[model samples]
Target: MNLFRLDASILPTTSTSAEIADTVEAEWAAAHPGATVTRRHLGTDPLPADAWALAATGGFAPEQDRTEAQREALGLATELAGELERADAVVLAVPLYNYGVSQHFKTWADLVIAAAGPTASLLKDTPTVLVTTLGGGYGPGTPREGWDHSTPYMERILRDAWQADLTVIKRELTLAGTNPAMAALRDLADEQHLRALTAARTAGRALAG
Candidate 1:
């Protein structure tokens, strides 16, 4: 089994999303024993700015004058596609920034989804897990619930474009002083996320077998 892990949390150390992803990866490795996992860290080295510009234009740049920037942009897209094609399962660890997925994560999604084939065909039927860490608490019934677009948008993109069966695990209220009673919520959330990843790994291994 091959697991593709994408980490898009900007924070280097105290990032809850990254910590959860680490736990998930560890759990996945433990469950699969011999399975291989490839990790892509988008926060450490962001995709070239030109990639964003080219994606916005929806056109490939001319080859004769193709600067390194242009090549890097295209390379990012190709690399992402290649990884997706080779993996049996995908895990995305992202932090909600202003009610949306981090820019790096969005860029990665755009590159993968831009392929010409049917969204589902290009992505195959890989199982996907989305883990998001938010600064404040907000759910389906909260007044500011509409601000929670990260999970919903991710679900729609993966399901519509890749026909992926996605499971979402959200960790909310990470801010300094949002809810006093929920002080230890982050650790609990991490435990739950680890379990989810373990399940995904088991399912992937069974399918491979």
Candidate 2:
């Protein structure tokens, strides 16, 4: 088994989302001993700027007319697409910024979803786990609930574009000034997220067997 971990937190080493992602990787490694794990850090090591243009164009511009920049961009996009195609399971550690996923994660999504022909579904039916860290909770009836777009958007994109079986585990209310009770609730939520990942792994193994 192989698990691909994408760390989308913009913060250096201090990001809570990155911490959660590390924990998820640890848990996954524990559950599947000897399994291969690949990590991509998008915060500091962003894909080349031209990668987006290549993804949008579906390929490199005409070779003879292609500028050096365009060629570099196409190369980056092809590399990213290759990584996405090879993963068996994907784990994304996404931090909610202004109620949306980081722009880096979105860019990766755009490239991977741009594959051609039958390879377009290379990510289809793959198991995906999303860990989102937010400043405030977004469950039903919570204040600012309507602004909650991370999980729903991810679900739709994974299902519609990649055909992934998506599972989301959110840790919210990490900001200061929240009531102690609410903080505890958020911790509980994180724990539950771990449990959910365990279950998902078991199910995936069973299906493979």
Candidate 3:
């Protein structure tokens, strides 16, 4: 089996989403000792910003008439799609930044979609796990309820567009103790983190089976 893990947190080591994903990956590794694991650090090595645009427009031109930049974009899209096609399962650790989606992730997604083209449905049915972290509470009943715009976009793209068999694990209130405004919610944050980590491990084991 092969696992393709994509980490989109700029703070690599200190990222809660990545840490939780580590738990899931650990369980996956334990279940499949010899399984191959591919890692893509989108935060540190984001795809070219212009790649998507070049790809989108290049499709209308003949390959031989494409500019060098367009050729590179098409090549990148092909590579990105190939990674997903090769993986038995996919794990994505993406964090909400400034109440918005990560541009790096969006670029990757765009490239993949471009590569898939008319046969996009071919990307369906794969088991995919998405781990997301929010600095503040955004769930129902919270003061900022309905304020999360990242999760819904991710779900629409991954589950609705790609049609992957998706499983999402979220950890909210991450800045409770660190941020003065949320100091009183420290305990809730800790509890949420623990639950999220436990769920991540459980999901990994189930996927391995």
Local error of candidate 3 at 150, Å?
A: 0.8
Model 3 segments beyond 4 Å from truth? none
Question: Residue 29 of candidate 2: its Cα lDDT?
Answer: 71
| lDDT score for residue 118 of model 2 | 24
Tens digit per residue, CA lDDT, model 2, 1-209: 87888887777577766666666666667768898878888888886555776556645346777767666666676777787678888777788888887788878777665444323665687877777777776777877777877767776776666777676667666562356656656665666556655544554443232
> Weakest 10 consecutive residues, lDDT, candidate 3?
115-124
RMSD of 2: 3.9
User: Please, what are the lDDT tens digits per residue for candidate 3 over residues 1-209?
Assistant: 99999999999878999998998899989988988999999999988889999998887799889999988899999998888888888899999988878989999988988878844753488888899999998988988898888999998888888887889999999988789989899999999999998899888987686
**Candidate 1 ranges beyond 4 A from true positions:** 55-72, 115-120, 176-209
User: lDDT of model 1 at residue 187?
Assistant: 71
Worst lDDT window (10 residues) for model 1?
200-209
Per-residue accuracy of model 1 over 61-88 as CA lDDT, tens digit each: 4576667665666666767778878887
The local distance difference test score of each candidate is: 0.69, 0.69, 0.89
| Per-candidate count of clashing residue pairs (backbone under 3 Å) | 1, 0, 0
